[model samples]
Target: MKNLPLSINTLSKIIGKNCIYVDKTKMAYQLICQPGAFFLSRPRRFGKSLFIDTLKEIFEGNQELFKGLYIHDKWDWSQKFPVIKIDFSDGTLKNSERLDKRIYEILYDNADNLQIKLNLNRDIPGTFGELIRLSDKKYGNKTVVLVDEYDKPILDNIENSKVAAEMREGLKNLYSVLKGQDAHLQFVFMTGVTKFSKVSLFSGVNQLTDITLNTQYSTICGYTHGDMERQFSEHLDNVQWEKLKYWYNGYKWLGNTNVYNPYDILLFIHNRMLYRNYWFETGNPTFLVKLFQKNRYFLPSLENLVVTEEIIDSFDIEKINPLTLLFQSGYLTVEKTFTRRQRLMFQLKIPNFEVKIALHDHFINAYTDLVNEKIGLQDNLYDCLEQGDVRGMVQVIKRLFASIPWRNFTNNDLADYEGYYASVLYAFFSSLDAEIIPEDITNHGQADMTVKLANHVYVMEIKVVDNANIDDINGDDVNVIQHNNSALKQIQAKGYAEKYRGIKGITVHEVGLVFSTTLKNLLNQ
Candidate 1:
């Protein structure tokens, strides 16, 4: 115990963030093993702070604590420095007016810790550069800087629209002070959740060496497969390691893929709990809400997704793209990736249970596509469809669409309004746990939808009715009749019937759903 070092506090599950603190002997001495000012961007609660603390212990020359760790032998233990760690997360300034004061507070705290005398009074020296000079003179060593959560304020106000812009500009100026004082700064490492513009922080002295994408450092901030095995081996079963991998792992950076979310995973094992949607409960996105305002239905994009590589890799936050939103927010991950011209060209998907349901809920709350009558619309629709009454289905569907909150279904936001109706109906039936596959690819063509009930399989197609003036082409029109006939023909032509060829006493029916506000209308003969 005498040689163990005070690791108890750092090892606690709840407070220490259930972080295994995967010993990074290689990264512990970034100065010797690597070069340049370091920066890392990981999703929220992914162990950025713990990594920063490890840096503090290593660089402050606390060698006894790191025995058997990565840098214990490689680092010169006796080299101590005037460590001035200023975390941007604590900054409380309203704007640029208090930037100098915040920097001074950081200086005062560091000076007090090192027992260094410094004339920090406004009368003697008030600016950040002045405090740095006094702190250096008080202690004969260079300063090692660590900045954490450097983008919190900007993210917090990102939704206000007006204040968000002002906050960004303010942070830009405050961080600009680091330019001239580069000489006094011995080693600097910054950790934050997102990568905002470096023009704001680096301010042209020495560029931020964005190790966020560098393969060597990609696993530096977040835990890798090996990190999981080595440190938390005791909790392997606790983490449901294999299941955990299915959910939180798949993030790719630089050339390498496969990393885990330390936050959700650690908390999962620490609490020893199994539940639904833990990560989404941690933080809500105002940007996502704003995006929903623009893309109300998300009908087309979500329904027919065929992502190209450029959209996946170059996605930006402000644009409010859903695929990019899911990727960065830790909902979806790159299952596979390809490269062309030395750049990543494509990536596949694999969704975890945590994300699959949240996205479904996101769709529901973000858009009011449902007709909202609550008038037993389901009871009526189900009764009509079950009876195979084509005329009855058409009348009911027309009434339902007329009740639709048409204002919610706007232009590009809803590329396929007909698809929206299908999804809503699917959701209504989903609670019953009936197998519902929309536009199921068939040998013939995409079947609009196929609901497999206890005894029967119903194939249905839906179309939109924009105005009542097109009444002559009502649900009884031949096109409606011919469409259902053609569907039946194709269903038979492509051997959709052959595949299910001959099962024990099974019935197949073709149904046409003409969606409108008049009634829930369907046609079958």
Candidate 2:
């Protein structure tokens, strides 16, 4: 089997070294054939940088590299254009001054590579504009500008609003120069993980087309199912194909073909077809986790987040929605999209098992008191469920709640309602990577949570009673054991497990949990 292109982001290197290359040249060709600036937004590690590099090589008239690709015979490689590529993934830009310094260094490097000299005293925007004109003049052809990770400067400081705004303005000024240099540009392409509003990034560049959700380029950056099977056919032995798809595939922008995370697949094949959370493990989403904690985002609601096109496209530093951030950052993907009354609407979901597990694991660690021992506890919980040890499972959950620091409850509004505990249960069960559902709908009503094991289905309903609420009940009737029994009775009375009544070999486990605000423990199980 050929070697996987693990962490390789250069198109020329991949093609020249005979690495596994999914032919996205058709899409690349289509993109450049049109005469306009373009922007594509995809998650990190989704081949955006490689795609940009491919465009650079193509426009630089490296026809030898295109020997067997789709665009080899189709592209007009006779005339090469001057390419000015800038990548923002190199350094940290904490403030506006740093952003300016980085941009100046990049512009200097580009000029140096192209053998052009520029005025040293000018600012970044001026230097950038001069570089474009000089490159165009030197080569006697229009320039092709490629900006990779275009939003990195602002994104780097997103957690700090004051600095992030400064970076945004600095980038905005630099990008605004592109509008004026349109006459000297043949084509311009900018790729990033998030889509900041054009007003902030592109400002006067109204001609720039955003193809982030355009169905035509949906498969541009990631590998489709066909691409995977065909490109990596030699590595298929000893690999679970269906499980591979379940773990890494299902990222969709539009159309029928779901794109797999390229980083996951590359690492999977490189590691001898092992399945793991390769993509999510590479970067820590501490900022996103902090956002979730601050917003008190209901963790379970991420499965079916409904939003409109405007919401997805309306991502700015000032108005960051957790759902939008998740979707654009590749943690979540569009599960379904449709037009409702002529307005486009979408339902977003975690893309696949890799994301589902990794995200919830991080969420559980951040939202709950479980820290270093979460993995061990999760493993024990999994074993309990597999062995049908309901009491063991209850003990695990009780221990989890016991670990929560009292201060967390005081600060979080989630402790005020039953759904808060339900959300915790959902995150915990989901971290196990089982076929679990939150707020599972049944014939009578919605169960708090449901877990479908190989031969068993666990239906759970959780109820939380604050100390103040317990005071309303009679002194003799308001015991924790009574509330627990009431919970079990409600589950049976409402026929929560009736949906699986006639299932052939599957046993249904109906679970009832009641927590007391005063006791801070599981009142009943």
Candidate 3:
């Protein structure tokens, strides 16, 4: 087997060191051949830095590195331009003063590389402007500017509004210099995870073309299906291809083809093809969890959330939508898009198994008081489902509800609705990485949830009883036992389990759960 370029980000190093590389030079050449500046927004660990380094090598006229690449003959080797690269992903930038110092240091390093001296008594914008003009003058060619993680400074302080705003202004001041130095610039590319408005970040640079959702370049930063088959065929042996696609593929922009997560693929291959949450485990979603809790977002709705193009693209510090943040941050992707009366609409969902399982794990932690016990609960739940123990599953669920503090139910409005219980149950099953379908549809009606195991199918119906609406049976109120029985009867009456009857070698199990507003524990099972 060939060596994988797992940690390599520099184009020259990958090419010179004989590492495996997916050919993206043709797309890179096409991007540079176009006119005007460009901006691409993709999630982190999506090969943006490697692409930036490839552009750097191309503009610096490193023709030897392109020997076996598509851009070898297409690009002109004699016409080399001076390159100015800036990477904001390096160290922490907590305040405005640190941001200014970092920009000046980068500019000074570029000037030194081109054998030019810059005046030390200027602000960041002034120093940057001088560096661009001087580099162009010395190299006798228009300079190419490439910036990586341009939004990191602001994103680092996103939780703090005042600090984030200050960082945004500092970056805006530095970027505003690009407009005046356009005369000496040949090409410019800026990449980041989030897309702040042009008026906020790129203030006066009005000519920037955002190709974030442009169909033509949608596969610019990821591996397509053809890429995996052709470039990575050597590692396909003994690997479950369908499961690989299900876990890592399905990330789409506007193109017909879906893209796979490069980081996950590399780690999967390196670890002897053992499937795991490689990329999702690398970062914590604390901010996202806080946002969801603060906004009281319905977690189940994330599977098929609808929004307009304007809503997804309109991200600012003053008004941040959790859905938009989730979409831009790669937790959710566009499952479908359509035009409704001249307005573009999208249906977004969790991208793949890796995201679906990991995100819900965090959601379970944030929603319930079982912070340290969630993993054990998830394991027990998975074991019970695998063993076809309906009674054990019911007991586990009862324990889950009993663990919730009393204040959680009374203080939050979400607890008043039946959907809240269903959502929590969905999160529990989903965290185990089970094949779950919420609101599973059948010819007769919709089931609350369905869990599919290897040899069994679990069809569940949940009912929430109001304290005031208890029925009187034989002069006594109908207890939780009757309500639970009613739920199971309704499932059978609607033929919810009949839909799976045709499948061979699978046993179908029916479960009915009822919760009373007055009683937090499981009233019926």
Candidate 4:
């Protein structure tokens, strides 16, 4: 078998080095055939850069690289366009001043590469337009502009909204030239991780078609199941195909086929087909975790969350939707799409098992102070539930909550709410891969959580109480004990376990966890 192209994104290098290059030229040809200005948004490391490089080679008339590829025989070899490429993937541009400087440098370098001289005194936007016009005039062909990581500057400072907005406006000043210089451009394709609203980023550019959700281009960036079987067949011999798919596959973009992340596939093969969170480790989602905590987001709602098209289509800096950020970041993907009330709706969920584990692990780490002890605790929780030891599970959970650093509860009102406690439980259970339903709905009411194992089902409810009076002589009159017991009572009263109890070979366990803010741990029985 040919060598795996581990992290080798350049199309020519993959072809020259005889690395395994999945043939994406067919889709590339389709994209370039009638391109005015196209935009594609995919998660980071999902092969957008490599796809951009492929388009660059195709437009530059690198026919030898395409000798056996799909576009070799069909594409016109004689017609070569002067390709002006702009890539923002190198490093972070933290502010608009630096962003403008980078744009100027890129334009000058492109001009130098194309052997065209540009007036250095003009502003970045003017220089960019001049470079396009001059490249076309010099080469006697309209320029093909391929912008990779087009929104990196903005995304780099997304946490700092002020700087991010400045970067956005600076990018807007540069990109707005595209529409005015439309006559000089043959094709313009820009790829980025997230799509800002057209008015926010694209400015006057209205013709730029967003092919992100277009079904035709859905498989353009990722590896389909057929791709893995056909291209990496030799590398995948004797591998557990089902487990591999469970860990790394299931990224969908409203297409019929769900594709595997290319990064995961490459690393999986290189590591001798071991299953791991290869893609998730490349970038940290600390911001997302903190955002989750800040918003007090419902963790269980991620399982079957339904969103409208408008919510996920464009991101606004002023109001960052946690769900939109999660969806766009590849932590979640479209499980299915359907029409509701004449409006298109999408149901999103965790893409695969790898994400399901790694994401929650990160959350658990951020939620508590037990850094090195996280795995041990998770394993303990898993063993307790696997053996139907409710007491053992309760003890393990108490340890989980008790381990949280006091600093986490100091500055925020997180300690006073049920969501904070329930969210922590949700993360711990979710990390263990127990079949979890948060806010589990039943005929009677919604339980805080429902966990399904092989033969045991855990129906749980959580309550947070200020039980400081439990130590007083007349604490019983304050009803602290009654309040603490009501958590379990609610589960039993609502018949939350009724549906699972009748199932054959299923043992339903009702668990009530009452937490005391003063104790910062489970309430005393």
Q: Please report the candidate that would top TM-score against the real structure.
A: 4
lDDT of 1 by residue, 162-212 (tens): 555566665565455566666666667777666554344445435557676
- Model 3: per-residue Cα lDDT over 1-525, one tens digit each: 566898889987787778888888998898888546899999889999999999999989999998889999999889889999999989889999999889888888888888889999988888999999998898898989999999999989989989999999998998888899999999999999998876677777777888888898889988998888888889877667889999899999987889998999899888988888998897668888889878767666775588998767748887788888888889988888998898899988888999998889888877786788888888888899899998799889988887877877666665556777877788888777677777779999988888886688999888777673334212233354445466787898999999888788888998877776766555666
Error of 4 at 30 (Å): 1.5
TM-score of each: 0.70, 0.92, 0.89, 0.96
Q: What is the Cα-based lDDT of residue 269 in candidate 4? A: 87
Q: Give all candidate RMSDs, comma-separated.
A: 6.8, 3.0, 3.6, 2.6
Which candidate wins on lDDT?
4
On TM-score, the stronger of 2 and 4 is 4
lDDT of 2 by residue, 1-525 (tens): 566788899977887677888888899999899667999999999999989999999999999988889999998888889899989998787877777778888899999999999999898778999999999999998999999999988888889988898888888888888899999999999999998887766776778899988988889889988987788888776677789899999999976779988888888877877778899998778889889877777777775578898877747788788778888888888888888899989988889999998888888877786788788889888888887888789889888888888877785466666766777777888888778777788778887778876677898888777763444332345345445455677788889889987899888888888777775657666
* Poorly placed runs, candidate 3 (over 4 Å): 383-390, 405-414, 417-419, 434-480, 483-512, 517-519
Better of 2 and 3 by TM-score: 2
